[model samples]
Target: MLLGRLRDPYINYRHRRLFHVLRVSIALTVTFAVVHLFPLEHSSWALVSTVMVMGNLPHIGGVLDKGRQRLLGTLVGAGIGLLLISLPIPGRGVQIGALVAIAIATWLVFSSRQAYAGLMFAISLLLVIGNGAPDFSVALWRSADVLIGTLIGIAATLVILPHKATDVLRFMLADNLDRLARLYHAHTSATSAPGVDTRELLKATSALLVKQRGLVDAVHREGRLSRGEVDELISYQRRMLSTIELLLESHWTTREGHDRINAMQGLRDQQHSLARDLGTLAFQVRTGQPISTDISPFELHSFAELAVGARGTDGRMLFSPSGYLWLNRELARVAASTAQRLASLERLPSKRLRRRAGRHGLHEAQRLDSKEGSQNDPGSH
Candidate 1:
């Protein structure tokens, strides 16, 4: 039982962060050994460069981006240092004035996208200036050390036990969807289980979204999810959360509304439908399988007809018994879109494989198409 729970995506994903920590630890140890073997002067700079490149990023794509930036910055900085060494500066006063001007110019780094590169340029210049005699070889040597550290850090992450951001994203989404299912279950239980506050869970889900936002760029860099697909996923999640929140905050949460829903057979059926749909969605997301059947409505219009008489004298839903019905319609729309996106995503790999197969594999492609067709047939369900 314990093994099963550990294997579950919702629980297994939390350990991914620890793997990254281990990767950094290994990289740092190797870097120290390299520095000691080389017996390079001012070797602490090498350690700094390694950590700067690998400290936060775990995935290949993210590490690549950081490594590229770090290398670019180191090269640029070293070039500036070499230029300073070759220049005929008059005296210390002029050198201080130039350093002050460079310091002021550093603000551009903060405003620009390639801030790392700019910061490195400044650091390299400062290090060159600090070392007396303006020696060109020393400046170049320091830059080389920095480069060695950067390569080791990046290589350790890419080859040592690489982790993909795509897997992290899939696991995170599965966990969030499961939490959403539980939240919906609790809100629905408000009828019989009053005061089952879901505000915290709702808040928690939003916080999870904040973490997801950072992962999207890494995943996109990895070429797992495209820009359009990211937009669709974002849209579905936002709409889903908003509609669920509206339902929980509406009059249906009160005991009086619960009594009214219990009295109506149709509303009760719709409630069950919503619960079942959410459960199905959670399973589909966790397993990466798509249902072939058309997405079902969260609440039937026939149920809305049954709720027609449940309005205020002013004809406003204003926390009336029918308010939940409209929210259900909105939820149905979100569910359909979410399901459609998942279905299309699941088929993408097969589509790519067949296209790559060419005329030489035409027969095999045909077989695959037929197999896929059978899997996607609505009638099979």
Candidate 2:
């Protein structure tokens, strides 16, 4: 019951919202504290921008990235400022050319994944056009100020309600496990249309990859996940996602092609099932006891048995439409794999098995209660 509530999509969203709000609040407090304490009379605009940028850093990795950008931008802008100040020629042409070069550099960096390069490029340009102080002094002051702000921002981000990337990684893994369960449900229902929707499955798989990237970035920033562990987790996620894609597209081919594809699909489904089970087992290991299985791919056997029983019944059949036996065979392969995953998990300590079974029993009870309520309802008919 508790695990189901934790996994609830609506509950997940609420937690996400609360986390975001907390991060924002911390950033604001840090910005105000810095501004009041330092009281820099001159470059208030620059200070304000730095505060805004620093305050919204959602994760440590992002904070570091912005800091790097600010540093690079300051140096480049400062160098330009010095050169322009030293130049005997005060021509507008020279200034325009310098500005253009800075713009090009910024664009090039921005094209890459370093989002902070644009700011750095702009800062470099600003330093080049200093009003009173020599370009070197202006550049020095600007760089120092930006560095101060960046440090303050990073400090605030790391200190305030500090979160571990590992938690996010676990959350994402849990979500993926849930998605896998849904996919199995879709497969066994016999209602999933003859051809699986490759696009929809791929979209979900792509989102998983995005989350993996986020996990990597978060760990890199906070040192929350070990490098080896991050690599292992990411590699596992990518392999599983690719395998799922292959399976999704396997059903749409010629007869000879179908047979070869079906064999591959069998292996693919088995791998997915094993992976999901391992993930569940890992969670159990982490949480000190095996969580009860609220959802099980193995239970999908009931659906598969129903399909087999419906075979050869005619066009009015309830499951696994023909001309699609190859597809159904592939699905059976997937079910077998799912069963293997559950079995592997069961082989762990008996305590885990008991806990998992206990959860499944609870879910079954709830399901029965729901059915009874529906049957009793006048509107149900």
Candidate 3:
């Protein structure tokens, strides 16, 4: 009941924002107190480092990543700063040139996955060596303060209103599958408006898939999902989306060819059936459970054939019935492949959301409860 209550308000955008605001406020307050408590010069760096770690990423994975980059950058920059201070440079110009070179090298790596690390490295270097006095003790203090602030940020993120990436990813993936199912039904429905603009919808779905890339490591660490399993799931899902896009085409054939294509049997019903399977897959993904029965592929009969070499006597490749048939088969193969890949996942029990919370996920709870009852029944025992 407590979990249910927490989730209800957490689902609200305003409430989520409030949670983050409170998190940052609490973390900063503690850091401020500590800064005043210490008898060190340049203590303001602590507060700055805390905000740097906590400002953008509210999710656990993102915070962990930012915290790691900040710590690494601070340590490396401080070490280099100490080394540079000891070097017998000819003049201030040489020192300045060396700093510039370091800055340029760091900025060049900003386009890679370690982009944040590069920025943090540059900032750390500047903090350590940029002050008028290049004192070794001052550099050590700045590095120490930065580390302290980063640790505080990480602690606050973990203890106060933490949003684990695994949990977020589960919600995201389930929602994606459900949304795709809705799109499938809408696009394939007989009542769909003519010339409907589905481009935006497709673009949005693809964008969500891209967002999943960051959370991949979270699942690996928290859910123990194998890299290959994650790749297959993502790859097949992409294939499914691409297949749907290809299915939206103007027939490259003559009137007779178009008629033959339209005459294909059971395409509409088959679409609806496939959408249902997609919905089921969404449920399974949310709960981290396998379906009792396997999701079967579309029957070959549904793939209606067109006449061989559909061209008007001019030898133009009008409507390649074979190509049309091949696409349908590809769609079926992809859909089936997606289900099979999902089923193949070696999901750890710990990965399952056992909480009977939230209206959107009640089915998983109810089903699990029923299964538990069966397991404990006296007659069964």
Q: Estimate each model's TM-score.
A: 0.74, 0.55, 0.78
| Candidate 3: clashing pairs of residues | none
Cα lDDT tens digits for candidate 2, 78-185: 666666666775556556656776768767876565656666667656655654334465455565666566666666656654444444555565455444434543
Give model 2 RMSD, 1 decimal: 10.1
Candidate 3 Cα misplacement greater than 4 A, ranges: 1-16, 87-90, 93-110, 131-134, 193-200, 214-232, 251-255, 291-293, 301-322, 347-352, 357-381
Q: Where is model 1 more than 4 Å wrong at Cα?
A: 1-14, 89-113, 131-133, 190-197, 252-264, 288-294, 309-319, 346-381
Error of model 3, residue 25, in angstroms: 2.1
Kindly report which residue pairs in candidate 2 clash with one another: 73-120, 76-124, 77-124, 80-128, 81-127, 81-128
Give the per-residue lDDT of model 1 (tens digit) for 138-208: 77778888888899888887765567666566656656665565566566542433444587778877887
For TM-score, candidate 1 versus 2, the one ahead is 1
Please list the C-alpha lDDT of all candidates, in the order they appear.
Answer: 0.65, 0.50, 0.66
* Residue 204 in model 3: lDDT: 76
What TM-score does candidate 3 reach? 0.78
Candidate 1 clashes: the total is 0
TM-score between model 1 and native? 0.74
